[model samples]
Target: MDFLRWTLIFLVLALVSAALGFGGFAADFAYIGKILFFIFLVLFIVGLIFGRGRGRTL
Candidate 1:
């Protein structure tokens, strides 16, 4: 969740920086956002895979 939040923050920053014509800062923010997004994806997938059937009534 935090990763996702930071990803969104960086992405928004990248958009804002680009709009303000700060090309270098925008690129760096975009890169960080991309990395955080991927990490969030991997973590989400791992959680889905390992978090099966915890409260089954068997």
Candidate 2:
């Protein structure tokens, strides 16, 4: 949940930075967004892996 929140924040920051022509800031936020996205992806995959073993799948 926290990761998703930060990811969304960084994504919005990246977009705003890009629109404002803050290339460095945009890149930084983009990088952060990518990291957070991957973190969420991994968590999701892990959840799926464990989820399938249980009767309740998310």
Candidate 3:
């Protein structure tokens, strides 16, 4: 969740910076956001796989 939050924050910052014409900063922020998003995706997948094996009740 934190990764997703940071990914969104950086993505929004990237868009805003790009709109304001800060090309370099926007690229960096976008790169960071992309990486964080992937990390979140991988973690979510792993959690789903392992979590299903637990068979815990809600």
Task: Output the number of the TM-score-best candidate.
Answer: 3
Per-residue accuracy of model 3 over 1-58 as CA lDDT, tens digit each? 8999999999999999999999999999999999999999999999999898887689
After superposition, which runs of candidate 1 have C-alpha atoms over 4 Å from their true positions? 56-58
Query: lDDT tens string, model 2, 1-58?
Result: 7888999999999999999999999999999999999999899899889888778558
Q: Which stretches of candidate 3 lie over 4 Å from their true place?
A: none
- How many clashes (backbone N, Cα, C below 3 Å) per candidate? 0, 0, 0
The lDDT-based order of candidates, best leading, equals: 3, 1, 2
Candidate 1: pairs in clash = none
1-58 in candidate 1: lDDT tens per residue?
9999999999999999999999999999999999999999999999988888466677
Worst 10 residues of 2 by lDDT: 49-58
Quote the RMSD, in angstroms, for model 2. Answer: 2.5
CA lDDT, every prediction?
0.97, 0.93, 0.98
Of candidates 3 and 1, the better by lDDT: 3
